[model samples]
Target: MFNKGNKGLFALVLTLFMLTNFVSNAQEGESIFNSKCATCHAPHKDMTGPKLFEVRQKWEEGGAMEGSLHQWVKNWQVAAATDPYAKEVSDWAPSAMTLFADLTDEQIEAVFDYVDEQPKGGAVADAAGAAGGGVASNIATEENDFGWIWYILGAVFLVIIFSVGGVKRQLQELDEDADKQVKVGSKVWVFKNRKYVGIGVLVLVMAGVVWLFLGLYQIGVVSSYQPSQPIAFPHDIHAGINGIDCKYCHNSADKSKSAGIPTTNVCMNCHKQIQGAGDQVEKIKNIYASAGFSPEGGGKYSGETEPIIWNKVHNLPDHVYFNHSQHVEIGGIDCKQCHGDMTKQNELPRVVPVEELNMVEGNIQLTRPTLTMGWCIECHNVKEVSTGTLEGKGGYYDEIHKRLLENDESLYEEYLEDGKVTVNELGGWECAKCHY
Candidate 1:
């Protein structure tokens, strides 16, 4: 009886240990989903991919869950061959999901376990709600600037001071001339004075030179240059309120040079279902009209579709080469870093103020930075490349870092002491990186 009790106690302890391991693995899977899949997929909602909440159920009921799940995760193409279940999921999402063949069997199992435990409707709604809040906050912060009021007040004060000084000077001159009772300093006499004439000419020449240099510096630069857009699109509604991902609208940043404008078909994907106008919807409808789409009835016309001619806001000189991918993909710079909170802008306004002196000017005023070569180098020198993580995956810089640590002991020790290698240290300031 004592032996039986001992065996039972041991079995209970082993069961508890296994359960704890399973829970830990499931939590890690959630982290993985948050980092990578959350951008495109959701547990319940049919987003870029199928509703993942019922993925396990679909796979299990179809009789290919275990083996197909393993293979589909490793390589979709390989798994899709014999796996009818995998094919069904793929058919739902026409766009091929990027394969994560590198993940181990254990990791894939953890992901499945996480999918099984996810609460229906709750996870998707919560994620969408959080994203909406972030967009709204960003828009609000941008719109609340008091810089323009201050600028007008300063100009008014300067004008008042100048007018007062001019009146006082005129009165003093009149009194002096009356007391003297003589022709006080004729215009010709003043002009003939070598000292005064020399000073006048010197001032004019200096002003001309400064003006010429300023014009040359501003030659190709366009600051505060808001042009009329085809669609009077309000970022506040789409990005801020609706909570669309910037990447969704500007999809090419991940894989290509340009964040190419969304095609008309992309617009129809959502706009077709939602035709009712709420102030900004008419603007969105204009985009449809330009693409030869009639919202009244009938489907898209087969005739020549005139693409909406959007005036590009951020224009770089032909000589300069700027790649959206390099900054976005490699450096992981946010779109808001350069473009400001576009969600707050109600109308497309011309950019002004050639040089940005502060965050107010740089972000709100839509001013171009004094983008001299030195200024570019200075930014690169200060900015640190976060070798911490890549799009929520493990840091891609880790391999290079490991090599540096193992091969160069002194350099590794110094880097550890400093806590980081700045962009400049990693040759980010090199001319070729930007110029080429």
Candidate 2:
């Protein structure tokens, strides 16, 4: 409560302080409302939760218990059991609203004040959504981006050139001081030490040739490339906490070469009821808008729809032959072996680097970068051939192992010395195995 004073200077200062405090609280309340409450409770629209505009008046008019509304924000269960009006509010929805036991009474009042102050829709909501996306994209793009590496390399090269030029100038000065002829240019200096210069040039030319081929090798490799997606999906929360298998969303992995992108109906399987939390609700709204799903009373498909443009994450070249079904089902390779542990991934799908993939506890360690031919070949060379691991199986493994022993005993024993026959020992390293 604010205290009142009668005197001139003291009263004026006290009034100014109270005004400042009120403004600060108002701003805080608005921020809290936008972050926590705005998802379900809007000012004008009755969304997932009821429209909260002047809700306090309605509660008070219906004879709410003193400070029960604030207590409800703190914990709905306790409020519902103790307060009659809060009990009535609990039956408003079948699913329970998320508890906000962390918010204080002052904060709750501020949220209410903030919600009341909002002038119903459009510009404000749009601005808020844009601001959130802009901030999130900037931060995430900054984190995993590699565009800065070239700039850093350029700066390093500039420094080296300056340092070398400085050293050359110093050598020229020393030659002048000693009354000896100074090599005025790079050509003159090279001529003076032609043998050493020739050797150095040869080494540099070989290095450049190697670098050119290495750059050409990486043309089709997409290691950590993450493109922007319309919806920000957190794989960690879904795949990790919820224990949803990769095959659930990517159902075609066991049947087809391509693991299909999930349709909007797949999203509706859960989001028909679970409207999501925070800014995620708006993203879900995009799905709803595209599916032409109206969730006013319950939900219904209007038979009109729009498309959601999803960029491909992992793309293989047309010339390369990679089968998802063969690797996932027949070969018994885990998705984590190639995709990294998606359970820990929070951002949109990215081409997981080989270094990160190797760091996964059970994954096979490899030296080459991800999505490169060398990387694939390296994996095939170390990954155990199913023929060696099969104990009682009477399929391809049994026939292949029998043939290896009967036809080529020496070669079979040589491979057996390592105790693990690799895929390369099978036709994995053959030109047609991947190239075709």
Candidate 3:
């Protein structure tokens, strides 16, 4: 009974309706996954939880009870208690999954539906990366060209000045009478001022020697070396504005020598909701892309990821032996004592110069190059070995202090001549301490 045009309109309406419903479900699923599931489950990769790609089909094939996977998502402990398959899955990750008793069966199904659609290779931001690369290349080219142009101009000017001077000299020489007067009189005039000339030469020689030593001192001293990071992660915003602790991200500082860079997942802990604006949006998008995430339409994992290649800002030679835990956990030294106050830092951290570091409120003033042997030795000589720090985590420092006071009282007194038992007294200056 319907006309052809009406029938066509009905089909179009139906198609749009289905698409709208599908997109809405996916968005809802993405929101739920990012909020509750992302901390553990990755779409294709095994994390704290097994990969959720085709997970429902896998569960069915694995002989899981009908609808048991949904129940597991709702409340894992209950599912583990009731079903043999769920119990086996729970053992895969030692850390227990949080109970999501509020999640409906339909919601769990939607999450699975969303996850199954994730592309295996993930979202490649080749366009964005290529654009950035092109911009970087153009800027580099411009900088090189700018420098070469100035150099060329300088050379041209130098040639012109010398040519003009030589021509002027030739013209003067053509006046033979003036040239003879100049040659004969000039030596006598110089001979009269020979004492003043000698004194001037001596002053110039001393100045050159002083300058040479100063320049030599700066050869290996790389202070304020600020390398560009892939992301301009403002420490002032995270640490000062938001009050996120340094240890929260650089979790290894108290455990290892390197303050480890936080993985992209760590950045997504808050960034899942905090999609930034302007220039930062591009940088944060790079994080999302690396974490296999789409930060649009509520967000979903794409299963593709690439690591952010960060340039090292602080580098120590292979021969040097440094342990962060020794200073951080045992000595109870504040991070600001070495790395300047991050709360005030607007850009990525660089090696703060000795002069600038002294300007900081509480840092011990040192006169040597940053991170040099002299700097370490100077800090050891000056920093007080207090009772609280000496009675550290292992009580080894306390025992050492006690032995110094009891067994080697005279040596202890001599060390305490400056009114404190500094690191220098505790065998900090031993060659084997750092070298080997």
Candidate 4:
């Protein structure tokens, strides 16, 4: 009886301990989720990553979720095998997620537990609706923006009216003074008031010189110059409508100085199978012919290939050094931020006048930022850097955070409070960041 009682007491204590641990883990999972996973994934809604609630179900049904989740979180390729779900998810988001092998088991459990408890309907619908609404609003705003054009037209009309009135008044004054003995002839007027005439001539000469220099300074600047491309590469179709990643075609943006143009082979990789381009197939066939291939059927040719030479519309001067990777990959700037909506244009349009003067310059297109250096400075000044530990978004900012910690310990401490650091605070505006 005594031994049995002792055994029962021990079992009771063990059960209580397990229950406490489970509850503690659940809370910790909530905290971990809010910090890391919340940025890209939600329990029931899709953002950059898929909805977590459905992921488990999909994984189990597809025979992928259970074993692959852990491996996928650690290394993408490891989970890719025998994990159809993982492959599908990765396809949806071409960018690889940052590895999270550092996360503790307790943290992972907490994340899963939190995901299990998320209320489903509201979150998913709200996110989808908001995304759709945002796109519609953006289109509506662009369509309705005639205010600036109207304002300029009105100002021009006012200037013309004032100039006509001034000319009429001057004629009236001349007629009233006609009877005076002083002649209106140029030689007589100059002789009568030689000092006034001389001053006026000097003023005119100085103004003309200033105007000439200013005009010369602005000669080579082409802000809104839309040139026709060899192949009407529609940015709107590739980027906006089809949702092809900017990095997909311009693969070098992340790895090299130039966002290298896509090779003809890259085009053939997709086009070989998709030969008929819905009336665009004929245009695509020309590309295949240039690359020495028969699109109607597989006809192998001698290994000779000639690439289509695209006219580079945006050429910067040799003196300035600008790396596309640094801005797009490291700084996390969207291609659309600079290139605008490429999909909307049938052919790549000259970057709007606003962006041209603001961001480009020179026959070599030096980094003067035609808009104003102050505008570039302002973006660098106000934008914040992401901290690696932030939820959902991958931790690309860790290296930057370390640099900040080394230089400004006090600022680093403040950033720790919010778990983020802004780009401005981290020396983003330094001339060397872009100019050098």
RMSD of each: 32.3, 21.0, 24.9, 33.7
Candidate 1 lDDT, tens digit per residue, 1-436? 3222223333433433443354356445654454345545666666666656657667888887567877876678778877777777778776755566557788776766765655565533355334531112112212221233245335433543443344345444645665455534553343235356445534543554354345334422334545445466667667777888888989998778898888887887788777755675777667667667776665565465766656455544323457787668766666655665555655662342334233433332222354334545665665556563333332555555666767896876675566766667666766676663
lDDT, candidates in the order shown: 0.56, 0.68, 0.66, 0.56
Model 3 lDDT per residue over 380-428, tens place: 8877655523545637667788788889888877877777777777888
Better of 3 and 4 by lDDT: 3
Model 1 ranges off by over 4 Å:
1-204, 278-281, 290-292, 296-304, 349-375, 388-419
> Using lDDT as the measure, which candidate wins?
2
What value of lDDT does candidate 3 attain over all alpha carbons?
0.66
Question: Cα lDDT for residue 232, model 3?
Answer: 75
Pairwise lDDT winner, candidates 1 and 3: 3
Candidate 4 per-residue lDDT over residues 1-59, each given as its tens digit: 32322233344334434433544554456434543455456566667777777565667
Report the backbone clash tally of model 3: 1
Residue 16 accuracy (lDDT) in model 3: 36
Residue-wise C-alpha lDDT for candidate 2, range 330-397, written one tens digit per residue: 67789999999989999888889988998998998998888878899998988775655447443565
Query: Model 3 Cα displacement at 113 (Å)?
Result: 58
Global fold similarity of model 4 (TM-score): 0.46
Alpha-carbon lDDT of model 1: 0.56
Candidate no. 3 TM-score: 0.56
